[model samples]
Target: MTGPSAVPPVTVLPVGGHGLLVELPTAEAAEALHAELLRRRRTGTLPPVREIVPGARTVLLEGLAEPRRLAEELPHWRVPPLSRTGGTAVRIPVRYDGPDLAEVAALWGLSEQEVGAVHASAEYRVAFCGFAPGFGYLTVLGAGYEVPRRASPRTRVPAGAVGLAGAYTGIYPRSSPGGWQLIGTAVDTVLWDPERTPAALLEPGTRVRFEPVDSAGTPIGDSADPDIPDPDIPDTPSGSREPR
Candidate 1:
């Protein structure tokens, strides 16, 4: 039930012909606004809109019937801090054998084993979805872990690669060029499946926990089934950049 002390100020701007972009001070504030909008829409109190997109520090409302009025009213709306409970929980088993594990350990002043333990110990939430269709920008709750990207971007970061950049962690949905610091590989985690109901496994507000597993797929310090089906890796590369 804990939340932010005060609601952050929002600046609503017009986007093209039928959109209003509400910019916030931080990603958490933006998520709060997005959650509020969704709640209003579900209650039939919000105006009709085609899409509501949450970004790093902004929420984009597209296909609004009254963009101008909505833009004016958005500034006055009190957006409560995002609730961290009652959301879909996803557990991802990760193999901490990434190429940049040693580099990340050096940056965090911890051993490679400690790095995995620290990462798996924290709970993360999907703040937003961007970079790719299935790629989600996950923020650690009550944690300030930050890491710099690679000096030179990789030509092709394989699918399932778990990486960190800035204050977020993301899994690559497909092979793509990226600069995020890779720390592990999500085992048998299918981020995007066209045939699935929502396609993206992780969405905004989804709670996630990374479970560290050995090379033989045994969970560390726990006994549980890790029989999730592996996703099919495509040869074609996606065009989206790494999540910031």
Candidate 2:
């Protein structure tokens, strides 16, 4: 159930309907496992596991004929490393015109320009996926940008909305009710047919940078934004960044 510090811990528990609960160190680790399982299923090493659900720090493995078989198989399973260049970067145009824009600025004691810099300045890691389908809770926003969620969540947060709450930032995959402070918007298709390859544009461990746009939601100029390497992806420590 536990591995060395370098290795992630694995726990096997029973959820209703015979699901195997696997606790991971972080969502990133769980994601790596999910991808690895998919790869193994294709390559024919691991047996067909079903309903691989990812959570904040847990991965639920379902449809194992016998829970003991899962426990024995766990020792042979390890999270695989994804290709450094295997994933694509998704660019989203943001209008930078949210109603809470000014409020967020004052909360962090930053000018509107400074606030924009913090949001657009760094690449974020998809730390975990939660709250809704296709919604990513990205980690490592510019340092001083940690703002709490709104006192009350919006009745309907439009799809493609880019918002920040606590130390995380995310895009609304659909029109969902939530409390993250809206800052901008992303037009990228966050969700679609789950049966399709690369079902979601955002994958775990992938990097993303916010590009500021105008009222029309077009790029700053001809729509080009520099890519910042995901500092959290590597073992190296991430540099300091301003808060959201």
Pairs in clash, predicted candidate 1: none
Please provide, for model 2 over 110-226, each residue's C-alpha lDDT reduced to its tens digit, 9 standing for 90 to 100: 777556656776666675676776787786654466888999999999988889897788888888898999987775445534787776766556677678877765666432234
User: Model 2 segments beyond 4 Å from truth?
Assistant: 1-5, 81-84, 125-130, 142-144, 188-199, 203-207, 221-244
Kindly provide the TM-score of model 1 when superposed on the true structure, using C-alpha atoms.
0.85
What TM-score does prediction 2 earn? 0.74
Candidate 1 Cα deviation (angstroms), residue 52 = 0.9
| Candidate models: Cα lDDT each | 0.81, 0.67
Candidate 1 Cα lDDT to native: 0.81
| TM-score of each model, in listed order | 0.85, 0.74
Q: Candidate 1: which stretches are off by over 4 Å?
A: 1-7, 141-144, 222-244
Q: How many residue pairs clash in each candidate?
A: 0, 8
